[model samples]
Target: MTALGLVHPGHGAEDDYPRIEQLLGSDIRVDLVHTDLGEEPRRAEALRAAGLAERLTAGVEELRLAGAEAVVWASAGGSFSHGWEGAQQQVRDLARAAGMPASSTSFGFVHAVREVGARRVAVGTAYPPRVAELFADFLRAGGVEVVAVRDGGDPPADGVAGWGEERVLALARDADRPEAEAVLLPDTALHTVSCLPELEKELGKPVLTAAQVTVWEALRLVDRRVHAPRLGTLFTREPVVQV
Candidate 1:
């Protein structure tokens, strides 16, 4: 079985691998290494000190040791905090260390948005407003337009992880706009896969979530572009949308 390495960029969501596995089905196995990023304060400080790159690199080698064929930094803000180019270099560094393809949830969001053919999108994030703004900027750099954004205001550590499905659904609903082609929820810490059908059904458009798209990005890196109709529009090879 092909193995996918998942690196928790320190938000303490250990259950991420199982969640990805569930969405990915039994064909692909996931090996995870969590780098223990501590509370939001410590996580933010690491971003400020530019410590996340080092941490992600460290975890990549760990996943390599576990025989993971590729790696994904599951936290979007971890890479996006460094801005667009910073996010690009972050994955490059990870791939260099792991000696395999690499990506971050941040980059995953960008690719996922493009996969859905969304030129304009609405973003809802659980990070502080500033961090949310950076993610939106990362998308713009990827050549997508962000029509609306909702910042959930930074909460304590595990704040996003603690959110129920209803909360995540609400955020997606709130982030949607008539002009937006898609709704983006950019936190891997949140549990999103179970309710993807309901979320998309309600919005009547694509709803891209972090964990879901991170898996999608991993598949792309490994050249496994199987369309997951159950996952959502992004996983399918269908045209994203016409500009």
Candidate 2:
């Protein structure tokens, strides 16, 4: 059984760990650590000042004590808020500090898209429209095209986690477009891990949600892939044909 360590930037969102466990089974242990991000609004400046590298290092040390093989920063907005280069550097710093493979959800979205072989994608988020646009910019900086993007804007401070599955999937459906090979919902706040199949069915494409890809990327960092049908196309076993 492989143990994975996750460092979340704020309180709450512990629901994600169990969701990952349900798909991958109880054998794969997930060690969770939360970092206090204060009560400040989750804007770019505030998020950059959150000092996740230091906090994440502590979490990594804790997970190492628990026998974790890899660690992941499970915040989508927090990492992307650092922009492309900064996000890369943040991950590098985390790996260096943790002495193990580390990743952030922002980069997880990119890696998931690349794994699915998509160059163009639609983004659906539970963030301010401007923040969602930042994600578009982030993807563009990574060489992936954003065909459509939409968001509810800043959701009254405490509103994102309370969003129901129907609401999240609606936002995803709205962002779905003809040119997009995948629809990306980039928020660790919303409870998305349970509705991946519903979202993928609604969008008629590979649907990548924040928590889903974060766990996937962490597994990928260690060269592991779990093929589960309920986890959507990304986790389905790739069929091999005779050459």
Candidate 3:
């Protein structure tokens, strides 16, 4: 059985993994290592920026020790805090440290966009406009067009993490642009897996969110392919799919 390692941000999203595992079917084992980035609402941004690489590497090492075949940084904004090149280097460094391939949720978004054959894309976020703009720039650097964006202000990062499914789904549906081929909701903190089928059906286009794509990318790295029909285009795409 293939083992995939996940380095998650905090305590809340642990319940989401079993569903991801079930969606992936029986060929893989997921080993998760939790790292608390602290809960100080006032220091969220500064903490996210400063602690990303350190947290990522620490989690990677732990997973490696636990016999994980691959490591995935399960936080979207975390690796992305360092910007585009920094994001790439972060993964490279993690991979080197872990003696295995490494990836992040931000990289997963990049991969998912290409997996679904999307070029022009629109993004929506529960982050501030400034934080969301960082994602926009990252996508631009990866050669994808960011047609439009909607930020739900800088809701306290913890509050944003605790956002309910209905509000999260509504924000995604409303932020989708008709002109764009795909919609990207780039927040790992938000719960998105349960709403993907509904979102894709309504949008009539691929909907790529952080958690879903991160799992997809992690599975691919370990040579596992999951055909979870309800999870939309990202999960349904073959492992050989480009990007």
Whole-model lDDT values for every prediction: 0.77, 0.80, 0.77
Winner by TM-score between candidate 2 and candidate 1: 2
Which candidate would rank higher by TM-score, 2 or 3? 2
Residue pairs clashing, model 1: 10-37, 116-240, 117-240
Which structure among the candidates has the greatest TM-score?
A: 2
What clash count goes with each model? 3, 2, 0
Candidate 1, residues 27-74, lDDT tens digits: the string is 888777777564443245555443366667776766887778788877
Report the C-alpha displacement of residue 40, candidate 1, in angstroms.
2.2
Question: Candidate order by lDDT, highest to lowest?
Answer: 2, 3, 1
> Per-prediction TM-score, please?
0.90, 0.92, 0.90
Please give the range of 10 consecutive residues that has the lowest summed lDDT in model 1. Answer: 42-51
lDDT per residue for candidate 3 within 129-218, as digits (tens), equals 777887788888888899999887756645665778678778877788888999998877677777788888878898998778878888
lDDT of model number 2 = 0.80
Model 2 lDDT, residue 154, Cα: 66
lDDT winner, 1 or 2 = 2
